[model samples]
Target chain A: MHEMALCEGIIGIVEEEARKRAFAKVNVVCLEIGALSHVAPEALKFCFEAVAARTIARGARLEIVETPGTAWCMDCSRSVEIRQRYEPCPSCGGYHLQVTGGEEMRVRELEVD
Target chain B: MSSERIIQVERDILGKNDRLAADNRARFRADGVLVFNLVSSPGAGKTSLLVRAVAELKDSFPIGVIEGDQQTSNDAERIRATGVAAIQVNTGKGCHLDAAMVGEAYDRLPWLNGGLLFIENVGNLVCPAAFDLGEACKIVVFSTTEGEDKPLKYPDMFAASSLMLINKIDLAPVLDFDLDRTIEYARRVNPGIEVLTVSARTGEGFSAFYAWIRKRWAKLKQAERTAQG
Candidate 1:
């Protein structure tokens, strides 16, 4: 699964931050995953435990904040919340939707000792 | 006892890959190369389409191919048979190709100025949608044999692709594939996605595909000239 690779990327960021901030150990890693980002939080958590082992983030608790998918409906001329990409506008029932938010996978903050 | 403090990072998880992809895009633009990332599910006949496209267009343009697979040089071998430069990147346990892998593979290819570079991504519809390899656009190859609801089931890939090539159209009649319904489903996911039907077996509809490539290449060249001036 690509979640494993993504976990590796997370560890990389964590280690880099550790070096830059002179942290000896990480206690928790905070992440922001969006609904449309195509990342499974459970799978990410499963992989993160394995990937974070033996690193500065060893035994780190992962705190994931999920954001809702949002899109701008061209037909409705308003913003709508969507759970998926192929969803139609709730107001006008049209597919002319431009994704406005919720495609992000970001490492927001870390709790360090 | 150590006191814990929150460190604000605020970085994208794919920032490294995105940066590398931007670098690859700059390199391709400077070299005047039109890059297309071809993606599809397994057994979608992506390699077959590439073989046919490269053989047909090689006479008019300098073409190079970068084939990605979990473990196989067979596609590259098949491409090399057409007397074109093809490099294979085996991703080992990886499911998809990343920008770092593509950048390394591209560095080993021959000089291809003012030409086309086709990156046949791993035959996967899911993971590849997340990684960008600095291609000008992504083309999804959909064979008629697959279920029409694939677009809805795998909306991310369909949404990310600019063009959807309905390949294996020769089998549509026998398979009872509803081309219109499939197009409708794809458009439901991506209203701006362009659609083309073709069969790599019969070489049908390839002329339109070639024409599409030429049109984009012309626009790229015009943009390059405008940037210079």
Candidate 2:
């Protein structure tokens, strides 16, 4: 899955930081896992541990913060929170949802010394 | 004197895989092989159809297959039994196969000879559709047992696939599948898309698929040879 590579990528960033004498232990890595992104946190955690071998992130902790799948409802003329891709606007039930957010997989922040 | 604190760094995680994928795609194009990345849900019979197709085409043309799965080299082993070159890519816990995965598998393939390669993407109707592995076609293989509403439920997959092969047609009489309506719905989602109904077990419609693949492979090879000359 893309999650393995994605998490690996995040670990790469973390490694680069550690190379520059940042924080090798990682301490904390925050991730914004959008609902529509189709990434399973548990699976990511598993792959992270396996791929992190011999790297700076071998024992580093992963803090994943899930982001709700949201959309911009053309009918409501507003951005509303959604639970899934096919979900209608929360405030006004409509199908014309232009997904403005969600489907995001990014490292929101990092705690390093 | 100033008291200041700053942290700046840039990094990419997919560096290795992405680079491998690009090189694989370049080699594929250079070798005159048109790759097809096939994706669908598990038990969608990606292997069965591939086995049948391989059996039918192994003699006339050179063909290769890249099998992707969460674990086991079962699919790759099966394809190899058909007398064609095959490679297995175990994703471990991955729910989908990315271009990077395909690229890594390419390294293990004997792609020096001009041939056709089929990448059986990890059985997933969603994520695989989101990532392009530089294949000439993305074939979505599904079965009648999985229900015809798959296209409606998985719009992105239906939209992403250039061809839809509704397999297990031999079981249509036993199921409640409306073959025509299913094709109609798929066409509505992807106009001008090619849809083929085949039962890999019954040997029905194999000839047509063989012809389709031949046309594509021939076109790619012709283009490659001409471009070289």
Candidate 3:
């Protein structure tokens, strides 16, 4: 749903970089998406192709680097890996947690000509 | 044959939006306008609450509204009926409002002097949660009829919001909705999120909501003064 909008944003970045770095065509785009970020990888890929059409990134392959959701448990005072936002701390079974990582959505790298 | 090159972009996908959001934030701070982005699913009473709040607070402080929807300037019309400036930005096919769109709308809006501006985002929880609209904070509203499991289903929206307004509280007693459980579920996702129950139709909890807004507005005004001194 919103993946299309996100893909549009990605294309914007790609085009901006192309203009700055003097690249004509983009071959691969590696993206870092966190589990807790709520972005669907498959949907993002699908939308990326559709949005990237007729652009510098046309026919580009999307390389998604899925990052694990990490949180700091308040009760146990330790960093824990979480699968979902509503999930309790894996180590302490407590809901009191502060999310530390795995919420990032960024374009990590690009292969271009 | 063309040779390939690896460019270390390493940029946030939303970097452009974040930059524009910072610009919007600076403009707002310079003007001392307390801006709040109201987001939720459709029919969550965002416009209703705004209409009521504008009516109540317009006398004390100048109020403005930026309404976002896929189509229709009706919400803007409704807000303007309260004698305040309201601009409508139709997203067409876009599900959420981005910072660039908000910045454009802000530029067109009149009355840049000190006041409060409410940017009502298009009705969708998932997409809006990802896009920051350069507001001081986000306020997510959910009706009691939407069920308590909403937070569990849409954790990102709950996690991103600074305040959660449980709207339609007057219908809570009639429905099978468990208000306590709803608040508990919201806290499960967002431990620090402030919750307030408000019935925009009945004006039951407007006082508390207004108080929260006033507190933030005062803080922004104070910052404006300190920056000047």
Native contacts recovered by candidate 3, as a share?
0.80
lDDT of 3 by residue, B1-229 (tens): 8779898988888888889899999888877788999999899899999999999999988778999999999999999999989999999988989898998998888875888899999999899998888899999999988979999999999999999999999999889889889888888899999999999999999999999998888887787778789
Which residue ranges in model 2 land beyond 4 Å of their true spot? A1-5, A20-36, A40-104, A108-111, B1-16, B70-73, B90-108, B124-134, B152-159, B180-193, B218-229
Q: Which candidate wins on TM-score?
A: 1
lDDT-based ranking, best first?
1, 3, 2
The CAPRI category of model 1 is high
Error of 2 at B14 (Å): 4.7
Residue pairs with colliding backbones in model 2 are A1-B94, A9-B13, B40-B124
Candidate 2 CAPRI classification by DockQ? incorrect
Top lDDT prediction, candidate number: 1
Ten-residue region with minimum lDDT total, candidate 3 chain A: A1-10
Query: Per-prediction DockQ, in order?
Result: 0.85, 0.20, 0.79
In candidate 2, what are the lDDT values of residues B1-229, reduced to their tens digit?
5322223433324444546567767878877777888888888888999999988877776888999988999999999998888989988877777777787777788754666789998898876765667788889998999977787777667766888998999999989789998886676445546988899899898888877888888898788779889
Instruction: Go through the candidates in order and give the clash count of each.
Output: 0, 3, 0
**Quality of candidate 3 docking, DockQ:** 0.79
- The list of candidate 1 runs beyond 4 A from truth reads none
Model 3 spans with C-alpha error above 4 angstroms: none
Worst 10 residues of 1 chain B by lDDT: B1-10
